[model samples]
Target: MADKLKFALALALVAAGVVGFYLLGEQPLVLRVLAVFAGVGAGVGVAALSAPGRRFIDFAREAVVETKKVVWPSRKETVQTTGIVFAFVVVLAIFLWLTDKSLEWVLYDLILGWK
Candidate 1:
């Protein structure tokens, strides 16, 4: 219950900051930006104290660990894969273009007799 209230308050602070940005349009740009940043920072700080926020932080840390464990492809492998993809795309495009031209010729020259 307390966590929920903290989350709600954080959300309200962020919302107020966004609204304040518009309301402070006549003010200096730097001040308006600062106000918005302050609001967002405060909201995030408050929300960070909640259970869900802690869970999210844990999840993010786990994700980073998992990401670090990933075996990324080498630069050479990446280049070879990209080259193969480009070759396949070029071949498919040529095939489709030929198919389209053949159909156009058959329809106009043979069947329609308009040519």
Candidate 2:
């Protein structure tokens, strides 16, 4: 029950922020943006007080920890892999171009006798 109320309040805060942005359209762009950010920040703060928000925070922390455990490739390995990819792409492009030109020649010059 308490969690639901907190979530509702957070949603209201966010909605109010959006409404304020449109209502303050005649104001300076900087001020309008600031108002919107302030509302969003407040909404997030209120949401963080809720049970679901706490679970989300826990999930985010776990994700960061798991990310840190990943084995990233070295700069040299990355560069070599990228170069290999580029070479393969170039070869494939040349092969396709030759295939297309060959088909065009056979269809137009040899088969159709158009030109």
Candidate 3:
């Protein structure tokens, strides 16, 4: 409860600082930096206050650990995949161009009676 209150108070101070800056027609850089830092601090305070937030942090930590266990693709594999992607793109472009020209031929020569 105390942490929640502190979080809210910190957020309010950040908000007030921003509004005051705009109202006063562009405040100092130091003040803006302080406001941003305070806002981030408030967010961290809120996250620290709750069990669910802590659980998320723990899950993220475990995910990073597990990620380290997996083998990443080699540069040779990456280059091969990129080559396959370009081939597919070229094939699809040819297919689409054929379809478009066929549709144009049918619509102009057959339907509307034009050359």
Q: Cα lDDT of all candidates, in order?
A: 0.94, 0.94, 0.77
Query: What is the per-residue lDDT of model 2 for residues 22-43, given as tens digits with 9 covering 90 to 100?
Result: 9999999988888889889999
Residue-wise C-alpha lDDT for candidate 3, range 1-110, written one tens digit per residue = 76567557656766765665566457687776676666666666666566656777899999999999999999999999999999999999999999999999999989
Supply candidate 3's per-residue lDDT for 68: 100
Runs with alpha carbons beyond 4 Å of true place in candidate 3: 1-25
Candidate 1 structure lDDT: 0.94
Tell me the lDDT of model 1 at 85. 100
Q: After superposition, how far is residue 77 of candidate 3 from its true place, in Å?
A: 0.9
lDDT of 3: 0.77
Q: Once all C-alphas are superposed, what RMSD does model 1 give against the true structure? A: 1.6
Query: TM-scores for all candidates?
Result: 0.87, 0.83, 0.72
* lDDT score for candidate 2 against the true structure: 0.94
For model 1, the superposed segments whose C-alpha errors exceed 4 Å read none
Clashing pairs in 3: none
Error of 2 at 12 (Å): 2.5
